[model samples]
Target: MQIMDVLAKLGGESGFALFFMQGGWKNLVMIIIAFVLLYLGIVKKFEPLLLVGIAFGCLLTNLSYFLGHGENALYHPEIWANFLDPQNTAAYHSYGYIMKNAGLLDFFYIGVKAGIYPSLIFMGVGAMTDFGPLLARPKSLLLGAAAQLGVFVAFFGAVLLGFTGPQAASIGIIGGADGPTAIFLTTKLAPELLGPIAIAAYSYMALIPMIQPPIMKALTNDKMRVVKMEQAREVSKTEKIVFPMVVATFVILLLPSTAPLIGCLMLGNLFKECGVTERLSDTVQNALMNIVTIFLATSVGATMVADNFLKLDTIKIVVLGLIAFAISTVGGLLGGIVMYKTSGGEINPLIGSAGVSAVPMAARVSQDVGRKYNKNNYLLMHAMGPNVAGVIGSAIAAGFLLSVFG
Candidate 1:
C-alpha cells in the first residue's frame, strides 16, 4: 500500500499527467512553434542574434505555464492585463504590484513596456551610421519618403480589415522595414500586438535579400539598373557634426513625440561624428546595443503566451505585415526609376530599392543588382544616401502615427 501511494503521487506530479490538463495542448502547440523559430534562428541563421533569444524566451514562457498554478511560473499575462486596465487604478500605470508579484521574465519586460530598449537601440544605430552619403545627395530623402507610401497604405488596409485606429497604426509601421522602430511604435499604440508585429518585422527584415531582388527586377529594365552616376562632393567634418544637431532640433520641435527616438539617434550620431567621445560611441555601438537587444528580444517574446499568439488575428497581422513590407520596397524602386528618367539615365534606379531602412543590407542589394548589369557600376555609396535617409524617414513616420493615434 505504501509503494502504491508513492507511485501515484509521482505520477500525479509528472509532466505527462499535467500535459492533459490546463489547456496543455495549447502549450504544446506553442512549444512546437518555439522549436521552429529556434531552427530558423540557429540552423537557418535568420536574425540569429535576436531570434535565438526570442525563441528561447518563448520556450521558457510556455514551459513555465506547465507549473503556472504554483510560484514557478516565470511570467503572468494576467498581471499585465490588469496593468493595462485604466479602470483598475490600483494596478494601472504602476509597477508596485508588479515588483511584489512578478517573475523573472516579468521583470525584464519592464524595459519593453516603458519604451527604453528600442530607443536605446536607436542610439546604437545612430552611432554606427554614416550620414555623409545622405548629406551629399539630398535627393535620396525623397526616395526614403516614397518608401513610406506602404506605411499609410498598410494603415488604411488594416482599418478596412476591422482593426481599431491604434491597432492599424501599429500594423502600418511594420512597413518601415525597421525592427526597432516597429517595436517602439507598437508598444505605445498596441502592446497586445507586439509579439506578432515584432516577429513579422524582424522576419521580413531578415528576408530582405530574397524579397527585394524580385521587386527590383520587375520594376526596372537592365539599362536603368546599370546607369552610373558622378561622385558626390566631399562632406566636411563640420557639416557632419552640425547635421545631427539641426535634424534633432527641427524634427523634435516639429513633432515633440519624436524626442525620445530622434533625440537618442542624433545623440549617438553626434558621439560618433564629434570625434570627442570615441569611448561613448564604442560602448553604445557594442556593449549597450548587445545588452539591450537580448533583453528586448526576450521580453518581447515572453508576451507570446499561447492564448495570445495562437489566434486568427496573428495570421491576419502576418499577412498584412508582408503586404506592407513588399509595397514599401516597390515604392522605393519607383522613386529610383523616376530619378533615373529625370537624371537622363545618370542615376541607377536600383539604388532606390535601398530606401527601406534595412541599413547596409538594402544598399548592398542595390550594389549587387547594379553590378550584375554593369561590372563597373558602383551603387553602394549612392544607395547609402537613401538607405540612411530611410532610417530618418521611418522614425518620422512613426512620430506622425503616434501623434495621430497615441
Candidate 2:
C-alpha cells in the first residue's frame, strides 16, 4: 500500500496536473477541430496550397502543452501587459519583440501583430495578377462594384452584433473573396479575428463552385443557363498592357489609401503588360507568389490554436462568412441578370456569378454551368470581364470601409 501510494503521488506530481485555463472540454474540442482542418487540407486537397501549411501550424499552436514546450496559454505578454515593470518599460519603449519569451503567441503575432506581412503579400499579389480582362471590358468594373453590396451589408450585420466598426468591417471584407484583402483589413481592424476572417475568405474562395452553383441554379431557370453569349472582341496586346497602369492611376488618385494594395495589383499587371518585363512578371506570378502564399498560410494558421479559435465567435465568423459569400454571389448574379436584360441577353447570364473575386474558379464555373446545358457553350472568355472586375471592386469596398471605420 505504501509503495502504490508513492507511485500514485509521483504520477500526480510529475505529469498531467496542471489545470487547463479553459478546461479539458475545450481542449479536446479544439484538438478535434484542428485535426479536421488538417484532414481537409491534406486528404481532400481543399486549397492545399494554404490549408496544409495552416493545418500544420494549427496543430502546433493548439496544444497548450506539447512536446514539453511548457505553454499553458496562447501567450502571456504579461511583463508589458502588467504595465508596471521597470525592465519591461524600457523594453516596451524599444522597437521589436522584447516580450519574445512571453509565449507561443509571440510567433503568431509576428505575422499579424502589425499590418506588415499582409501588405507585403499584397505587393507580391500585385506583382502577379493580370488586369487585362478588366481593361478589355471596362464596364465589367461596374459589375465588380455591384458585387460589393455584400461587403457593406455584412459590415452592418456585424456592427449590430456589437463589434467595433473596424472589427465589423474586417469581417465583412471576407466576402470580397480575396484573401489578401481580408488579411489587410483585419490587420487594421480586428487582428484577433484574423484567423477566422482569413480562413473563411480563402476557404470560400476555393469552394466557389460548390457554394455558387446552388445559388445560381435557384435564381435562374434552366432556359437562362443555355443563353449564348457573343464572342469577346479580340483584345490587342497593347490594350492589355496599358490597362493596369490606367486603372491604377485613376484609382489611387480617387482613393490614395488603397494605393499600397491597388498599386501593387496594377503594377503586377503592368509587368505583364510591358512585355519587356516578361521575365520579372513570370517570376512574380509563379515563384514569388507561391513562397508568399506558404508564409501567409502558415502564419495565419498559427493563430488558430485552441485558445483563440474555440470561442463562440469563431463559429460566428465561419457562419457569417458563408452568409457573406452567399450574398456576394447573389449580388453578382443579379448584376449579371440585369446586364443580360439590359443588353438583350448578349451577355452570358452565367458570367454574372464570376463577379465574386474567386478569379478563375468563378470564371470556370460559369463555363462549366453554361456547358452543362449547351455542350458547345464557351463562356470562359465572356466571364473574364466580371471576374477581373470583382478584384477591383473588392479593393474599393475595402477602401470605403477603412475610410469610414478605419
In the range 1-406, model 2's lDDT, one tens digit per residue, is: 9999998887754324432333545545656777887788778777888888777666555555332334454533332233324556555434344354555555555555555556656656666556656666777776777777778778888888777888889989988888888888887667678778888888888888899899889887776788887655667888877777787889989887677678888877777778898787888788877877776776677666455677888777887788888898889888888887898877767787888877778889989988998998998867878887888888888887778876
Predicted structure with the largest lDDT when compared to the true one: 1
What C-alpha lDDT do the candidate models reach, one value each? Answer: 0.90, 0.74
**What is the alpha-carbon lDDT of model 2 when measured against the actual structure?**
0.74
* TM-score for each predicted model, relative to the true structure: 0.96, 0.86
**Residue-level lDDT for 316 in candidate 1:** 88
| Candidate that would win on TM-score | 1
Cα RMSD of all models vs. native, in order, equals: 1.7, 4.1
Residues 227-265, candidate 1, lDDT per residue (tens digit)? Answer: 888999899999999999999999999998888899999
